[model samples]
Target: MEIRLAQRVQALTPSSTLAITAKAKELKSKGYDVIGLGAGEPDFNTPQHIIDAASASMNEGQTKYTPSAGLPALIKEIITKFKSDQGIDYSPNEVVVQNGAKHALYTLFQVILDEGDEVIIPTPYWVSYPEQVKLADGVPVFVEGSEENEFKITPKQLLDATTNRTKAVIINSPSNPTGMLYSEEELLELGKICLEKNILIVSDEIYEKLVYGEHKHVSIAQLSPELKEQTIIINGVSKSHSMTGWRIGYAAGNQSVIEAMTNLSSHSTSNPTTTAQFGAIAAYAGSQQPVDEMREAFEERLNIIYNQLIDIPGFTCVKPQGAFYLYPNVKEAAKLTGYKDVDSFVEALLEEAMVAVVPGSGFGTPENIRLSYATSLDLLEKAIKRMHDFVESKMKA
Candidate 1:
């Protein structure tokens, strides 16, 4: 029997990052030594205090369904977090909790976008942005952020891209694939244009706490009252607290939009898991020392591997300011190694060198590949050596 899939999903591209990760796992199961750098998750477990809080909630019989918007107590914690972290205030009614940060974004698009509405997604974006916008019957308008500019779109570019159909522009910092962050001056400039055009700013700040060196995270919503009114912030404990498996993320913005998202969520997911919500509450309210420790470890690993990665022949990379991924342009390496393109180079890397990396075409750029340094420092060093040895041998051949 043949079943027809929906047209909405027919043109949808599967996530390239996940596809390679799955392939690596398959080879590992078959006794091949495969090192996967395809996933962006933290290698750490959930903080013990958070786990204890979740267990305590269950023991105290707080496991029933929560409000569609979220638990009132959890909402309070989110509000407090915004005030402390960004000095931006969000009232209780202005937030909606969902399954994950990804779901938070999906729900926002569903509520705000009508058919044919356009969202300006900067290039080298998270893989799901375009697909989510399209699933909501919206058009994705792309503006390329070249490597020279650190992959951040300028305000002039934002202004030029503005059209009557432009409903929102996503600002992801520290970005997923690129790890670039927009500074205060940069965000202010872009915020002014968004204000002028009356376009919403969808700020994805999931990696806000993962910044390194002198780089700092500045949320566009914190720029001004008008900008705050115009921006919808999407964040969660997945990256910040290592609670990916717990699945708690939320959105904070305009009352009407949040209420709409909350209503839609009621019909869709009912509400996020009650126990997970409690865990998220603890994640925000508990001592943040563990988050700091994890960030420090990632920074150390990044410093060690960035040097090794660039030492490979025909490879050049921009040091990331935040997040755990390293995106290096490998076009010259591909050419020198005799592969037709970066995609094929990546496939050969996995099949032969036993290292899995995400080709940049998945993020709308084909000259580079993404590698995550979320694993131990030893594994990262070994993986880079494997990649270097592979490229050198291929060049010699």
Candidate 2:
């Protein structure tokens, strides 16, 4: 028998983070003491109220198919959330719910892009952004956001990347891997360029609520009516509400684009899970104390562990303003520990030190590694100590 796969599927790169996680899990299953610092979700459970809402919905027989885009109630909650959180107004026609924020992004690219169209992506980006763009037959144009600037692209950089085929640009504040947030001023400058160039903005704000002390999350869309009109916001409860498994994410943007995405989703997901939609509605409409508590815990962990991590031999890092990941430039650590690169160092750390961290190469930056603090304080401490000891033994300095 002969089998063939489509070129798009063939062109996809498997996630390095997931691969490392698989290996870590394999070791764990064999009773190895692996301390995984590659987590991407909150360590806490979903809020009790949200769980109760989903359970209540199931008990009350609310588990039938919903509107292809989402339940109307869920859409309404999303609308209210935007108004309250970002001070942006959205009509129901401009919002569409998808399986998750990842899916929301995937669907957005599908509807908005055509073959050979270009989307500008800042480097050190989330692993899935470029992949999703490519899946839509859209060309992803990468622009490096130097670590000196905390890995944020400049307005001039965005201007330089624009071309006749440029269709959109992605702005992921409180970014994954780097955990950097764009200032309001910075976003305004970039938004001006996009407005002049007529490039649509895809704003990924999944980590909006996880910002740390003295730093706040700002949406490029929140800058003005013009910017809001030019931007589509992709957000979900996964990171914000510890609802990773619920898979309820929504997009708010141009009515026409939203309509197309809704039509596309109808033929695909049909609808997000009914119970999960109910849970998301409750997540938005209920008290947000749990979200705040989770943010505080992450901040405490970041403050404690960032200091400890940088203390390790040959490691230097930018203190993240938000999110739970610590991205440290470990090229020196790699060299000092007798490894040739960050990827090999990460592998050796996992196998020898039993501390699992993600190599930054997957995020388009090979000199660094991402260590997620989305675990308990005790485990984070243990992982750092292991890395410290491993480096001390290998580096001898």
Candidate 3:
């Protein structure tokens, strides 16, 4: 029987990051020593306190389904976190806890967007943003973030992209792939433009806690009371607390949107895992030491590996200020090494050098490649050396 799949499923592109990671794993399973730089989460384990909390919840029979939105306790902790970190305030009714930050965003797009509504996404964006928007029946309008500007779009670019059909704009600071952060002044400029255009702001601050030296993560919603009302924040403990497997994330914004998402989730996913909610509560309310330690380690790795990456012939990388990924322009290297594009270069790297990194094409920047520094310095060093040697061999050929 020939089955007709839904158009949405047919149109969706599988995440390239996950694809590369899987390929690397397949090779490793077959006894090949493949060094993978495609990781999207912290290499660290979830804090023991969070694990204990999940165990305690299960032991106490808190394993039953939670409220579709989230546990009141977890919501309270989320509110406290926003107040302390971003200086943003939200009522409990305005927040919805989903399976993870990704799900939180998926729900947000579903609730707020109508068919034909256009979402302005700045490139190079997270691999999931455009796909998620398309899945929700919204058109994604791409605004290029040039490498010269550190991959950030200017206010003028945002203004030019706005139209009658523009429903929202996504802002991912400490952005995935590039790991570049937007300064307060820059965010204020962009927020003002969004406010003037009456476009909603979907701020993805999943990497908020992972910022590096001299750079602070600013929430666009925190810029003003008006912006806060117009913005929806997407955050999770996955990156911050190394709780990716816990599958707990939350969205904070307009009450109407949150209620609608909660209603949708009730029918769709029910509630986020009940035990994960308890664990997330511990993540937010527990000691800050573990989070701090992880951030320190990532920063250390970034500092060490970034120098080596830039020194490689034909590679140009801007210093990443946050997140765990480094997106380096490899177009010159590809051209120098006789490959047609970064994707081809990446494939050869994986097959020949036994190293895995995500090609930038999936992130809307074909001239670059994203290498995650979330792994240990030892593994990172090995991966970079392999990549360097691979490039050198190509140049000689």
Candidate 4:
């Protein structure tokens, strides 16, 4: 039987990060010693307190479906979290919980966009943004972010990209692939342009709690009350609380937009996982010591690995201030080693060195590759040593 799938399904690109991780797992299952540096989540377990909360909720018979938006108690906690962390106040009615931050983004695009609406996404974006926008039948317009700018686009760039059909702009500070962050001053400048143009802002701050050193995470919505009205903040416990598998995330924005997202979610996901919502409540309302410890660990790993990564022949990288990924430009390495492109370099690295890393082409930068440091320092050291030996051998060849 011939099956006809939707054209949109045919147009979608499978997530490259997941594909590489799965390949590494397959090789490991075959008794190969594959060191995977492609993961997006933390290596640590979910804090015992949060896990206990979920268990307690289940024991107390709280496993039933929640309100479409979320349990009211969890929504209140989200509101309080925004006020305390970002200095932005949100009422319970202005927040909606979803399956994950990824789903929060998908629901936002669905509620806000119409056919032909353009969303200006800065390049080297999280892999899912453009795909999710396309799923909503919206057009994604890209603005290239040069390595010189630490992969962040400027206010002028934003201004030049704006069109009458532009409906929104996405800002993912402490960005996924690059791990670079936008300063408060930078965000305020961009916010002014969006205000004048009436463009809605979608701020993906899922990595807000993962910053290192003196660098701080600032929500664009916190820049001012006016900008707050124009911005929708996407975040979840997936990264911050190490609850990736629990799938609890929420969106805070204008009341009308929140209502629309809630309505859409009702007909689609119904509600976020009920026990997970209870766990998320404890995550936000309880102690934050575990989050702090994980941040420190990531910082230590970054400090240990960054110098080693840059010391490799023909490799260059911008030191990331937040998140756990290092995006190093390997174009010179590819050229020096006789590979056709970064993708080929990545493929050969996996096959020959038994190391897994994601190519930058998937993240809209073909000159680089992303290495996740979410694993142990020992594994990281092993992976980098293998990579260095592989590149050195190619150079000698």
> lDDT by residue for model 1 over 1-397, one digit each (tens)?
9999998899899999889989999999999989889878999999999999999999999978899999999999999999999999999999999999999999999999999999999999899999999999999999999899999899888989889999999999999999989999999999999998999999999999999999899999998999999999999999999999899999999999999999999999999999999999999999999999999999999999999999999899989999999999999999999999999999999999999999999999999999999998998899999999999998888
TM-score on alpha carbons, each prediction: 0.99, 0.99, 0.99, 0.99
Per-residue lDDT of 256 in model 2 = 93
Model 3, 189-276: lDDT tens digits are 9999888889999999999999999999999889899999999999999999999988899999988989999999999999999999
Q: Residue by residue across 162-207, what tens digits does model 4's lDDT show?
A: 9999999999988999999999999999999999999999999999
What lDDT does each candidate get? 0.95, 0.93, 0.94, 0.95
Candidate 2 wrongly placed segments (more than 4 Å)? none
Native-referenced Cα lDDT, model 2: 0.93
lDDT of 3: 0.94
lDDT for 283 (candidate 3) = 94
Off by over 4 Å in 4: none
- Please write out the lDDT profile of model 2 over residues 1-397, one tens digit for every residue: 8789999999999997898899999999999999998989999999999999999999999979999889999899998989998899999999999999999999999999999999999999899999999999999999999989999999999999999999999999999988899999999999999999999999999999989888899998889999999999999999999999989898998999999999999999899999999999999999999999999999998988888999998999999998889999999999998998999999999999999999999999999999999999999999999999999899874
Q: Tell me the deviation in Å of residue 64 in model 2.
A: 0.9
Rank ordering of all candidates by lDDT, starting from the highest = 1, 4, 3, 2
Residue 57 shift from truth in candidate 1, angstroms = 1.1
Model 4: lDDT of residue 7:
90
TM-score of 1: 0.99
How much does each candidate deviate from the true structure in C-alpha RMSD?
0.7, 0.9, 0.8, 0.7
